[model samples]
Target: MVFSCLLFGASALAAPAPWYLWRSKLDGQVFCAQTPPGVGWQRVGGPYRDARCENTGVPGK
Candidate 1:
C-alpha cells in the first residue's frame, strides 16, 4: 500500500508540457503561442510588403 501511494504521488508530480510560440512571415505577426498539453494558434501581424516573415520577432529568413 505504501509503495502504491508513492507511485501515485510520483505520477501526480510528472513534468509539465512545453510551451511554444509561432510568428508570422507576411508582416511582423506573432501568434499561435501555447504551452504543453495545450495547443493553439494565433495571428500576430498582417501581411508585410516583403515576401518573408521578417520582423516577426524571429531571426532573418
Candidate 2:
C-alpha cells in the first residue's frame, strides 16, 4: 500500500504528464489537465503535444 501511494505521488509530481483538453461533462466547458480531471471531465482532443492545450478556455485546468 505504501509503495502504491509513493508511486502515485511520484507520477503526480513527475514532469509533464500528458496534456489533455478536458471538457466539462456538465456544462460543455473546455479546459486542460495533466490527467483527466477526475469525474465530470472528458477528453477534448488527443493528447496535446505541447502546452498549447493551456490556451484560452474555461479555467478548469
Candidate 3:
C-alpha cells in the first residue's frame, strides 16, 4: 500500500539510533549497543526508543 511505502521511507531517512537495548539470555543482563544483537543476545526493546539504553556495544559483556 501507499502508506506502507511512506512509513518505510520515513524510517529509512531517520538517523541511526545511538544504541539498541539488548538482554543477555545467560544472565538476563540488559544493556545497549550500537548494532544488532549477536548470539546469546535478544532485543529488550525498540531501537532508539529510550536514550537510557545506550551503553557499550560489546556483546556478552
Candidate 4:
C-alpha cells in the first residue's frame, strides 16, 4: 500500500502543465502564455505594440 501511494504521487508530479502562446502582432514574435489551471491568460513579454494574444499548444523555439 505504501509503494502504491508513492507511485501515484510520482505520477502526479510527472504531469506537465498545459501551456499556450501569445503572439505579437507588430513584431510577429510569440511569447509563453500559460493559463495556469484556473487562472486567465497572461503575457510573458514585457510589452509590445497592438499585441494580439492566442492560445497555442507548442512553445516558441
Candidate 5:
C-alpha cells in the first residue's frame, strides 16, 4: 500500500504546469511563468508545453 501511494504521488508531481506569457499593463513587458505574476499583468501568450514559450500544441498523447 505504501509503495502504491508513493507511485501515485510521484506521478502527480511529474506533470508540469502550463507556461504562459504575461504582459505587464504598466510597461507592456512580457514575462513567462506558470501562473500570473501579479496585479496589472495579463496573459497574452499560450499555455505552452515548453519553458521557452514555443510549444503551443495540445498536450498529452
Candidate 6:
C-alpha cells in the first residue's frame, strides 16, 4: 500500500503545471509562466495545460 501511494504521488507530481500568458505593462511584450511574473505584468491568457499555451478545453477560442 505504501509503495502504491508513493507511485501515485510521483505521477501526480509529473503532471504539467498550469501556465498563463502575461503581458508587460511597460513594453507590451507577452510571456508565459506558471505564476504571475511580478510587478508591471498583467495576465492576458490563461490556465494552459501545456508550455506552448495550447490545450484549453474549448477547441479553438
- Compared with the true structure, all predictions reach lDDT values of 0.43, 0.70, 0.69, 0.47, 0.82, 0.78
lDDT, candidate 2, 5-58, per-residue tens:
999998886555556788898999987666767799888774655566744433
User: Total clashing residue pairs per candidate?
Assistant: 7, 0, 0, 0, 0, 0
TM-score of each: 0.28, 0.52, 0.48, 0.26, 0.71, 0.64
Q: Residues 1-61, candidate 4, lDDT per residue (tens digit)?
A: 9999999998876634445555555565655534432233344543222223343343232
Kindly report which residue stretches of model 3 are placed more than 4 angstroms away from their true locations once superposed: 1-14, 49-51, 54-61
Candidate topping TM-score? 5
How many Å off is the CA of 19 in candidate 6? Answer: 0.4
Model 2's alpha-carbon lDDT is 0.70
Clashes of 5: 0
Candidate numbers sorted by lDDT from highest down: 5, 6, 2, 3, 4, 1
Model 1: runs farther than 4 Å from truth? 1-10, 25-28, 35-61
* The 10-residue segment with the lowest total lDDT in model 2: 52-61
After aligning candidate 6 to the native by TM-score, how far in Å is the CA of 33 from where it should be? 0.6
- lDDT for each residue of candidate 1 in 1-61, tens digit (9 for 90 to 100): 9999999999887753322444544444454333222233344443332224333332222
> Which ten residues in a row are the worst by lDDT in model 1?
32-41
CA RMSD, predictions in order: 11.7, 8.0, 9.0, 10.1, 2.8, 4.7
Model 5, span 1-61: residue lDDT tens: 9999999998986656788989999999887788788889999988888777888843451
Alpha-carbon deviation at 44 in model 2, angstroms: 1.8
Candidate 5 structure, TM-score to reference: 0.71
lDDT of 2 at 30: 87
